[model samples]
Target: MFRILIVEDDEVITKALCKQIETWGYIGKGIHDFNHVLDEFNEFDPHLVLMDITLPFYNGYYWCTEIRKTSKVPLIFISSASDNMNIIMAMNMGGDDFVAKPFDLNVLIAKVQALLRRTYDFSTVQNNLEVHGAVLNLNDTTLNYENQKIDLTKNEVRILSTLMENSNRFVSRDEMMQALWETDEFIDDNTLTVNVARLRKKLEEAGLENFIITKKGIGYRIAE
Candidate 1:
């Protein structure tokens, strides 16, 4: 289930939003310590964030900017300040959408649903392996990671996708070879090792170091 972080200080509003989030079949968490908002955000690792403009210590904009530094998770601004300036500022501060306060919960839920569907539905509807902030678009055999992109050969894509799909589990050499051979001629054992080594180097260059780990004589695993 997708997890959302609520950064509203109002106890009543926080509780109500959490209940609404649960009813909509999403996980929700509210921040209790305004001073350590970023810490709470990292710990939660939420898929989305709902933040208030005016806050006790640093305000929503500050926290939103902080989240942008490490992740591309969607952020939505919720506040009583509905002025154009606030909305514009929210977008400028890395918020994906804005929800004005004193609003209908159903309407808010609708917005949330649309955002979630737009962001996540397309992937689930199509079975794709995603990892380390990168998406392996199975339809095209392309790897999209943030702003950079790479096209993969059929076998290379299958190998990486399988390892990524079963991340943290050792993918035996035999299993990998079987997957590779599905589309083309049998790949020699050394060929698989070479491909994996190259893939690991590429991932490391893309800032995903230790993405794949070797088990010496056994197999390879996507490192946890």
Candidate 2:
């Protein structure tokens, strides 16, 4: 199912939007932590975003710019600021469309459907896995943490993806090896160890010490 993230602050409006969105067979979530909008966005990995211009900590344009850095997901701005300047600014800030406040629910849904169709028709939307503020872009196999982007080798990506996919749960060595085997590379026990060590080093260099934890004779998991 396609997921939509709503970044509005008003409780009533947010609830209404979510209800309307879900009624149309799409999952909708609202942002409760205004200060961590980007964090929520990463965690939800929504296929599209409905953003408001007026917000508590940072405005919609700021969050829009941040999201654009890593994703090309369709974003629509819904705000009371319907002036031509704000509308143009929304587009310039990477928003795909603008919907002024007091908009008809049907019209909004139509816009949402149109953008979703236009954007996803030719491409698939790959989601990012986020744990402890670290975002792993499945589309590009890169890691983003604290404003730093770290490139990962193919094996490193597979290892990290497996661990993060089962975050906070032990992933046995056999299971990890199985994940790596999908790459059709010759992966032995020693190779897994070396790849994990290298991956851990990269995480640590990015200030993510202890991001992955190990248990003797067991396996590894993302730190809880």
Candidate 3:
């Protein structure tokens, strides 16, 4: 059975959508923590995600990009924002389909079925990033080491993803910020510093001391 994760903010909509998804013989889980949607995502480990465009703290695009980093799971954007720009942005941000609000339930179901068939029919092994006996489960954004599983926030996941993708190579701060912030919003330099500090602290606590090393004035890297 397939599982769908609904990231809608409306209580009625989330409940209704989950009901319909359940009726379709698939399990549905609704995200409760808007501030930490990724956490719920990792917990549920849905096959498909039903997301809205606008959300608290960050938008659907940010989450979509974040999810894309770890998994190729399909996502459909269900929102009242149905303009051409919104639709195009949704696709650009990795949405498999877009269902405008005031949409037909039958049509939404058809799309959902189609995307599930297309995405999961021929899936491959999930990838992980391993370094220094610490393994990062890309699918669920968890770091495993010494029999301990450390859940990673969206930002921390992206940070580790980028660094590990270029393992042994320094990834500059600018590159990481671009990877994290695909939107036009300006992010302060201190924000990156804060995120990296938190990530480093987590690694240290997990017994992987100096898992991520600063390259002087360059950037950071995970040594080979």
lDDT of 2 by residue, 44-147 (tens): 99989999999998999999999988777789999999999999999899888999998998899999998877555423544677899999886556899999
Clashes of 1: 0
Steric clash pairs (candidate 2): none
Stretches of candidate 1 off by over 4 Å are 127-224
Per-model TM-score on C-alpha atoms: 0.59, 0.56, 0.55
Task: Tell me how far the alpha carbon of residue 109 in candidate 1 is from the true structure, in angstroms, after superposition.
Answer: 0.7
Off by over 4 Å in 3: 123-224
The alpha-carbon lDDT assigned to residue 6 of candidate 1 equals 93
The CA lDDT of each predicted structure is 0.82, 0.89, 0.84
Which candidate number maximizes lDDT? 2
Worst 10 residues of 3 by lDDT: 118-127
- Tens digits of per-residue lDDT for model 3, 59-167: 9999999998877678999999999999999988888789999778778989999887644442234468887778888666689999999988667887887898788
